[model samples]
Target: MKTNSEKTIFEMSVPGRKGFRCAPSDVPAADLPEGLARGALPLPELSELDVVRHYTRLSRLNYSVDGGFYPLGSCTMKYNPKACEKAAAMTGLSALHPLQPIETVQGALLILHETQTILCELGGMAAGSLTPAAGAQAEFCGVKMIAAYLRDQGQTQRKVMLIPDSAHGTNPASSVMCGFACKPVKTNARGNVDLEDLARYCGDELAGIMITNPNTLGLFDENILDVTRMVHEAGGLVYGDGANMNALLGIVKPAALGIDVMHYNLHKTFSTPHGGGGPGAGAVCCVEKLADYLPGPVAAVIEEMTDEEPPVYGLVEPKKSIGMVRAFWGHFAIILRAYVYCMMVGKNGMREIGETATLNANYLMAALKDVYPLPYDRVCMHEFVLDAKWKDAPGIRAFDVAKRMMDYGLHPPTYYFPLIVHEALMIEPTETESKDVLDAFINVMRSIAEEAKTNPELLTNAPVETPFGRLDEVKAAKDLKVAV
Candidate 1:
C-alpha cells in the first residue's frame, strides 16, 4: 500500500553518480592493511534535487518541540526560544575557537563566568563548573569528585551509590561508570523515596545517593529535609540531578533543601537546543565544603592591572581537584543561549514559569484522568505519571497505546518508565504549551483509549498515516541495514 513517498530513499539512490569530487590518490599507494576497504561503498547517489526532497521527507517524520506539543516527561522538550538561537549565533562567542587564549576570549569567559554565578545562586551552592558538556557528563564529574573525596578521607570502602527505583536510567548507569555498585531504593505508595528503606542503606560503606527533584514520575519528595538530614548525619553526600528543572526552577532551590551537589541541564531548563546543540552545557554546583574537589579551570575575577582592570581571566585552584573533565572549555555557544534565556526571564518570571508549568500539568491530569488511571493521586509538581494498567487489564499494553498516539498526529508521551509503576505513561506538559494545544493532545489520547477498548487491533499496528509503519525495533537496533 505504501508508495514512493514511503520509500524515497530507494528512488534517490543511483549506482554511478557522485556529487563530490576529490583529487585522485596522488601519494604513492602502499600495501593496504588486510581487509581494510570494503569492495564497494553502497551510498545512495542522486541529483541534488532528489537528495534534498528525500531528506526533507525524513525530517518531517521527526516530532520536534517546534513541530508540536511535546509532553515528554522529565526530558523537558519544551520550545527552545528563537532568541537563544539568535544570541548563540553572534560571532564573538559562536565563532571563537575554544583554544583561543583566555585573554583573547575574555568576552566569552565573562559570559561563562556570569552563567556560573547564576547557577550558584539558583542551586544555592558555593561555586560551579561549566566544564561538564551534558547532564551525564556532569553527573560523572560530580561522582568522580565524590570518589576522590572518599579516597582522600580514607573511606575507600564507600563503594556503593544508592539510587531510587523511580530515578532516571542515567542515575544507575552513571554510578556504574564511576566504578561503584548501585543499590536501588524503592518508592513508597506516594512515589517518594521510602525513608525506612533509605535508612537501611545509608551507612559507612555508602558513598552517596542520586536524587531527582520533581522525580521522573513528576512528584516532589516531601520528605527531602529528613532525607538530606539522614544522609549528612551518616557521613554521605547527595547528588541532585537537575534534569527536571523546568518544574522547580524558581519555586524552590535544591541546595536549600540540603543537597550538597547538583547539575543543571541548560538544554532542558533554559531553552537551549539539545539534539542540534552538538554539545550541551551542564553547570555543576556544590556546597563550599565539597567545592575544593570540583573539576576545573575554575573561572574567577582577578586583577589584570589592578582588581579594577576589567578583571581578566582569573583561575582558582582547589586544594584537592578531580582534575579536568574536558580539555579547553565547555560549549560556549550553548552556554550563551542559557545565559540569554536566564537574563530574559528574571526572578519573578522564573517563578511564574514554574507555576504555569505545574498548573498546566495539573490541568492535563484533570483532562485525561477519566480515560487513563493516575498511579499516585496527588498534586503533581510540573508533570504527572499516569498508569495504563486499566487498559492493560484487557491485554492492551502501554506500548500499544503509545504507538496509537502517533496515528493521531501527536508524539507519544513517555511510556513504561520510572519502573515503580506498571504501564507508566509519564506526561510533562511544560508551561510553554497553551490550553488549546493541551486539549488537542488530551482529545487524541481519549480517542485512542476508546478505540483501544472497542478495537484493539488498531492499537497493535499503528501510525498508519506516517510514511513508515511499525518497525521491528530490535532488528533496527541490533542489525541496522546500512547501505555499505
Candidate 2:
C-alpha cells in the first residue's frame, strides 16, 4: 500500500535534473570561509513540477482546523478568521524590522499598547505585559514576577506554590523554575479545589496558588472566591492560569474574582493559529499591586499633549521589573492577529463567544455522555472528561479509540489527561463547529462504541485508511531512525 509521494525527495532526485534556474553572477564571487565548503552539496535534484507535487502531497497529509474538526480538549482549537490573518500579514506591520526606531514603528507599538489595554480591561487588571512568547512562558514570567515582588517586600520565607491537582502540568514546572517549591492541592468530588486541602496548605511558606478557571476538567471551581480568600489570608497571592480564558471572556474577570495575576493565551482565547509547537503570544496581566514587577518593555503611552496633539505611544520598562523574559518582545505577528480578533469581536461579540463555546461543549458532552461515562455529570464550561471504559473488554482502551477516530477523517480528543480519571477522553468542541458536524462526530463515536463491544479487534487495529496502519509507538519512540 505504499504511495509514490511517500518517497523522499532525495529518492526521486535524478542525476542531472534541476528544478530552478539561476542567472550568471553579476557581482564578483566571494569565496566561503575555509573548511565551510568541503564536498558536493547533499541536495535533492528534481524538476520544478516534481518539487511542487512533493510538497503539495505532504501538505494534504496534515489535519488542521481548515481541513476538518479538531476538538482538542483544554487546547481551544478554534477556527481563526481570515480577516485576522490578513491583518497580521499586512506589509506595514509584517515588513517592519524589530530594531527600527521607535518613532517609525509607532503604529505597531500602538497595536501592542491597545491590545494590552483591552486585555487588562478584560482580565480586570491595572496593567499587562505582552512579551511572553507562549502560555508556558507566560506562566513562568508570572511566577517570577510574584517571586520578585515577594523578595522586594522581604518575604523570603514564602517559597511554596500551591497548584490544584487538576491544573495543567506546566503550572508546577513554571513555579519551580522561579525557585518555589510546588505543593499539590486536591480536587473534591465536585471537581473543585478541596477547600480543606487549601486551608491545610496555606501557611507562612505559601507563595501563591495557581488555579485554572474552567479547569482541565472543564469545570469552574465555584469556591474560587473562597480559595483566593484563604490564600490571601495566609499572605499569599493567587495566580490564575488563563489557558481556559475562552470560557470567561466578557463574562468573568479574574482580578475581580481575587486573582492577583494571570496569563491569557492569545492563541486559545483570541483565535490565533496554534499547535505544531507554537508561534504564539501570551498576554500576562496583573493587579496594581504587582504591576511594577511585570516583565520590562511593555507597550505604554510615553507622552501626551494638551488641547490638539494625540498621545505618543512607545515601549517602557516597569519601575521594578523582572527584566526581559524573551528577546525583542514576543511573537508580534501573533499579537497583531489577536488584536484584530478582539476588534472584530467587540464587547458583545466576546460574550457571545464565551456563551457559544460553553453551549457547544455542553451539547457535545450531552450527546456522548450516554455511550461514554461522564466523570463529573454536571454542566461543563468549555470541555469535559469522559471515561472510555464502557466496553467490557480487557485490551480496548482510550488510545485505541483515538487511533480509530483517524479512520473517520477526524482528529481525536485529548486522551488520558488531568491524571484523575481512568482512561480519560477529554473533549472540547469549540464554537466554530456546526451542529451537523457535532452530530456526525457523535454518531461516529456511538458507532465506534458499539463496534467496541461487537468487534474489539476493529478498535485495536485501527486507522486502516491512513497512510500507514497501527505502529509500535513504544518501539518508534525508544529506537529512532532517519534513513529510509
Best by lDDT: 2
- Per-residue lDDT of candidate 1, residues 1-484 (tens digit): 6564656465657787766777999899898688997777656777677677777876786778898878788777888889888888887767898767667877777888898998888888898988888998899888888888788899889998999899988888888998999999888988888999999988998888999988888889988888888888888889999998888777788999988889999888988877644578787899887899888877777655465567776566566877888766777778889999999998778888888999999998988888888889889988898888663448788888888888877877888887887888999888899889988888888888888888889988886877568989899889998431
The C-alpha local distance difference test score for the whole of candidate 1 amounts to 0.83
lDDT of 2 at 248: 90
After superposition on all C-alphas, the RMSD of every candidate to the true structure, in Å, is: 3.5, 1.9
Clashing pairs in 1: none
The backbone clash count of each candidate, in order, is: 0, 0
Compute each candidate's TM-score over C-alphas. 0.91, 0.96
Lowest summed lDDT over 10 consecutive residues: which window, candidate 1? 3-12
